[model samples]
Target chain A: MTTPLLEVTDLKIHFFTDEGVVKAVDGVDLTIERGKTLCLVGESGCGKSVTSRAFMQIIRKPGKLVDGSMLYRFKKDDGTDEIIDLAKLDPKGKPIRQIRGQEIAMIFQEPMTSLSLMHTVGQQITELIRLHTGATKHEARNRAIEMLQRVGIPKPDRLIDEYPFRLSGGMRQRAMIAMALSCNPTMLIADEPTTALDVTTQAQILDLMLELQNDYGMALLFITHDLGVVAEIADDVAVMYLGKIVERSDADTIFNNPKHPYTQALLRSIPKIAMQRDELEPIKGMVPSPFRRPVNICQFQPRCNQRFEACSRVEPVSTLINENHSVRCLLYEDVAAVHQADTEAVAHG
Target chain B: MWQYILRRFTYMIFTVWIISLITFAVIQLPPGDYVSTMVSQMINSGMDELPPDFEQEVRAQYGLDQPIYVQYYKWMRNIIRDGEFGYSWIYRRDAKDIMVERLPASFAISAFSVLFIWMIALPIGIYSAVKQYSLADYTFTLIGFIGLAVPNFLFALILLFISYKYMDQAMIGLYSQKYETAPWSLAKFWDLVKHLWIPVVIIGTSGTAGLIRTMRANLLDELNKPYVDTARSKGLSETTLLWRYPVRHALNPFISTIGWILPSLIAGELIVSIVLNLPTSGPVIFNSLMDQDMYVAAGFILILSTLTVLGTFISDLMLALLDPRIRLS
Candidate 1:
């Protein structure tokens, strides 16, 4: 395939909080190509949001970039490619700034708070446009109005003068999208953007996003815990459990044949209309707190119904099963002698 | 919005009325009126023989013979009809005239202290918060604790001592010897500026430290907010991200502080005024209190409390303007 617009390899973002090192995003790998959507799906604390924040290097204080390489390839205005290792850029330096909001933009989970209440939504959009494009304020105003219209705000003129508090949740989320896309960024990272909206609004926001992605042709990194949303909008799906991606595949494969027990469990938990009326099975146990993560075992081994002796002794590494599927589960591993020896060791004990 | 302001304005009038009544009552609470205080002073100073009708004449001159509510009504009528706050027994001048002369000095120094306190506090607070746990943050944090620990009077005295010992100029008042009573001129202005620095430093240091601690805490909380993250993710420069988003969010409480700061500067300056010998209303009203100059003390109390109430109204108006969330409500 053409060079991925962004490729993250073995990314680890740890928050050095007072309690201890929180391995919030540990050894995650992700990729998204231009004009395509990749959904990073996980329950809370699985580090989907943290990994997306890694791209912008906007993680909160007490959070550190322990180790990672995020290689972002941009097609410059002249149509030639430039690749930069995003991890190494000083978060406060000049180069990262040029790429930020200009090359990449993001929408957040809480539409209520994602846009500053103190500033007019139009001013917010215009400010970003002006900052990145060096356009005159008047020109940016026009661009902001145009974006507000494109995002389906009525009376762009009046709405342009209004603050975020005046807008409804869907409208605010749309405003956020409008602001994020104003620069025609090379990539858009949306962290659970529609999770807070009502069902109808959520669908509309997803549709607006997909439509906007088509219009802008930007790579989309969509992070959400909602599998239905993943099924609806994701071109590629990566299922995360406890800060690691345990399964990666195209949407259909991720749903039809999830290999990792965590992904299978997540798929099972998605309520279906066709299923017999029954109480939904939540994953058997709570996600282990970051401070208590097992150092050398599969993080999901405790919760995995199919867990085994080897699962408790060693961390399971990703094993490629096909051109489009990868799984991190010993159940799918080709039973090697090391596992046999490990099982023997456990048996002797 | 106009309705809100009008309602607030009405409340302000009521507030001022209640404040004036309370101050008048409290001034009366000290067990003697101005004539008693004057007669006692005369007795202590060897003028033991009472002049015929001396107490009666003194009492009649100030209208002190009326009942309490009647006296209040007379005072309120004078204020309403002629803008007169009554007469100062000690200065033997109209209280309004005393206010006119003294208001400027108190306002100038106190206003400067308020402005100086905020200007110094906000930026330091923002910096300390954004770079929390950094060396500068720790250093400023230490200073902030020190500011909170030491009383304002002590801080003022320490500054006074330092200025006297080091500068040798004493920096004793809001103006130097020649300009203390001098009429307005560029020379007076410069001297005012020169003297202004000492009180501003004396008063502002502690205020700056206190506000910095508060602003830092408020901004730090806002810095973690989702809007701030969104702003940063949009690649707002660190300065832009700070000043425009989280700082703006953090400013509501700080703006509301304007009400507290207005009278605080004036009230907090009283002890400092005594220490530095500054010719501000603090010491003037303070002397009135000691001499039991009823009208002057009550008048100053009335004016300062009005300012405090007015300050709260102004801050509320500002809050409504600055925050749309509040504006809608």
Candidate 2:
């Protein structure tokens, strides 16, 4: 099988601040195959957004990617295998510039601010196209309008010249998406794209993104805290708690059989619209402060019900419970022995 | 917008008129009238001791023999109706001409100082903000305090010493020679600038310190704003992020204050020019006040007032440009 489009292995982002060193993203590993969607779910301050920003190499001052190897394996123009290590790419070098926007585009939260207030929405999109593709102004203009229309913007010809402030929140988001997608990038990193929109608009944007992903055959890295959103768009899910990935697996396995107590608590906390109010159970206790993180198997030990004494003594490694699913949890350590014991007992009974 | 301008202009006129009236009154109330002073000085110097009729002639010449209210009424009428600034007793020329000649010099010095101040402050301030608490920031802060603490006269003395000791030349104080040396030629103007630069810088150094501190504080605030982070997430270059968003936003307060900055600097230039003996408004007004040349003093005041008004207007326009939310309306 060919390598995935993007693979982030052992990613760690730390911040050196006046207070102390903060491990913002500790040992986060994620993969997105071609045309697949990987949703990162966590509460506020969980470092989900930091991990996504790390992918784009846009982490701000005082925050830095201390260690990480992000490998992008894609087919070059000559159909030759090309694998570039993102960690090795110089931030100012042409390779990173070539990948940013041309290969991977990002959709930011707060569309109004993300879109340049000074430029017309169309101009912003057209400029990006011209910058990456070297298209003539006229060609880029047409492409921009087409992208806007494809994104379901009304009267793309007229709307293109309007500023972001002139457009509604939903329309601005669509304009942002159009701008990001105008370059025809291979991967889309949507960083809470729908967090600021109204619920109805959120659904529309999510659907539009999914539709575009399908049409363009692009991989997606969706960074959000809303599990409801995850349930809808993600094929794979990663749960982060205090800068570390607490649990990660196929979406089905993660939703059905969450082994890590934090994952289970997160799953339980998501209020179900289909179920009664009383049936809903939210996660107990707040996420621990990153500054006060303990050296142990689980960062969730304080809130986790299944946490044992041993969990505080040593960190747990990821254990593969199935061919496609894996989780970092002490509870999953005896799964194979338990399965064998259950088989013998059932036969005797 | 037009209404706003009209209202501001009206208020400016009212303020100038009130200040001028108070100045006129105070100058008149002083002991030893201008006519008596002239006559006494003539007699004391034994300059043929003006004829016995000279006392009446001097009083009549100045219209000082008229009632105070009447003199004030005529003065107001001449200013309002004839648009005439009366002659100066000391200069023996129209007060308006003296003011016109001297106002530009003061303004030039002020303008040059302001330009230097902003040019130096902005970059240093921005770098200090970006480097925050680094050695550069601490060093600049220390330098700013020094600039603040040193008085203009002392600064002028220091500059003179530096020029004499290092450059092996005597420092220019104000003019090349005196006001009678030459008319305002380009060479003379440049010479005047060279002479005045030390004083101008001395006066402006404090202002530069203030501006640098303000810019640093503002830039820090802008850097911490969420929109700056949003800009970063858009894959914008660091230069663009710093200059386009943070710098522009940070400059709004400084830009808006330029109107006040220019006039206030001009006011400050007055004192510095006097100390440095520059042929500028400070000494001109100071001489007129001592000689009871009310017209020249009032005229100088009026010119400075006008500059302040115009400065504020320019600042308003700049604020609108710098701050997007300040719409044209």
Candidate 3:
């Protein structure tokens, strides 16, 4: 009934290199409701990280958001809903800066390298707090200490003065989380934040993130290639291939009744308990290079086992199978056409 | 930290002692002493060969008749006890006085050249790295290569020619003719400043070019690091992000280079000083070595070695201060 926290429509990000333009993120659409998790699952170079970076307007040079509008909804001081198109704002201008860490914050993959070794963890945390909140030095310090404690770090007082290199990988990730959550942002974008951690530490970090998300009631955009993590944390799932999303649905539907062949292939690839190690089946073929994207056809057709004749000639648009599920595949075109006709007939009647 | 510094200082003293010993020995390695050179000069001028007693008397007067170790011990003891640097045979004065007189000018030129190098190289290097592969970056790379390829003395000559031909100004010495022998005064200082730029530019060229390449490469590497992106994601301004993160890391290498600057104060730009006719330590040392002026040459070199040790110690301390990882280790 209420508007989603953020709605991204037709997002396209291109990287212009000397060789050619790399359509790194082409036509990605996503929605994140308040207090829910959206896991973007994809293989490497599939543009999941790039899409999340676009939300923060932190895309590095050579890669640019060439099209799309990100409609972000937030409450003003007067308790009224206000909408802004994030894509239209100048990335380097003051408006985006004010909204960046305050409204939407991000955590990265490499905790060891994400925090600057030159500054104390306390200094890094307080810098963000003061930048957005305009808090006094003493206030920022106290807030940073409190945040460090909240992130489950022991002896926050002592660790505050320690440099990032002095902390373990999990502790560094925790510090990063504390810094991201310090501003009480409405949305958090985490790009494979646990990829570098061991299994135990990864699980701890995931639990901490879930607890924090529940407490803050913030929308989470979790990007990862790990299906196990997605199953554990994601309420909604979107499968990405190359630069396009192939399937999106509620987590249960995606796990139980995956519509797109790419999603099925990805599910089959995950190693299961009680199964032999050699029994795992990986998706066939390398992801086609971004420079040579398939023309006028489904991006996943080459990798799909059940691909039909129409898949090679027609690019599949997102087709709704039900109220809560959508897939981009030529197999579902007839269902989408029937649904469209029904909607049109009802509107006329 | 204090203990570390004290240990380093101790090592520095030992290093300086070894350097002094080596310098004294190397200076004495030539075939003859200053007295023999003087006798040869006198004989070449058509005088009859000096009597055997005359050469022995001259050698005894200069302490040259003593064993090499005894000569070294006496020189070192005199320097440690009374700050004396023995006697200059060529200038007929104390070596200390000659060094004190010429060293300030050399120090000024070297200090200003280092300042010039840092000031120009830092901003341009940061710019070149941030705008890598841009037209400006390419232009600076070209200029840096040219600076590094051309020798300092040759560059000095070219600058002198340019200034003479185009500006009609003979940019040759540290001061105009009037201020050459003038005592220390505001006017003499200003005249020195007016002529200081040429040598500063010449000496600083290669160092500046080298530092620019270093800084650009260092900063370019730092710029891609994940910490930079993390800082940017915090909504810091681009300039703030750049200066606070990558530039801070890039500056570590430059801090370590401060060690070499002290020795370069006396030894750098030797030919440039000779070509420009400046009254600096480089030419004085050169002439002293050529004439077998043992005390003056040894004293200058000893001071240069001591400075090098002190500079390295200072740079180590500065590096530890800048990087916490180094500090803890």
Candidate number of the best TM-score = 1
A best-first ranking of the candidates according to their TM-score comes to 1, 3, 2
DockQ of each: 0.78, 0.31, 0.68
What is every candidate's alpha-carbon RMSD to the true fold? 2.4, 5.7, 4.4
lDDT of 3 by residue, A1-349 (tens): 4579999999999999988999988899889998899999999999999999998898988899999999999779999989999999898888888888889999999999999998999999999999999999999999999999999999998999999999999999999999999999999999999999999999999999999999999999999999999999999999988788889998999999998999999999999999998899998989887788897678888888998755666678898899889898878888566456545545755
- Place model 1 in a CAPRI quality band: medium
lDDT (10s digit) by residue, model 2, range A212-294 = 99999999999998888998989989888788777788788888888788888888887767898898887778766678887
Q: Rank by lDDT, descending? A: 3, 1, 2
Per-residue accuracy of model 2 over B277-318 as CA lDDT, tens digit each: 666788888788888777888777766766676777777766
Q: Taking the tens digit of each residue's C-alpha lDDT, what string does model 1 give over A1-349? A: 7679899999998898889889888898878888889999999988888888889888776788889799999777698988899999999888888888989888899998888888988888988998888999899999999999999999998999898888899999999999999998889989999889999999999999999988888889999999899988989999888888889999999888778888888878878887766767788889887899988677888898998778888667788899779888777777884477577757866
lDDT of the structure predicted as candidate 1: 0.86
Pairs in clash, predicted candidate 2: none
Q: What TM-score, to 2 decimals, does candidate 2 have? A: 0.86
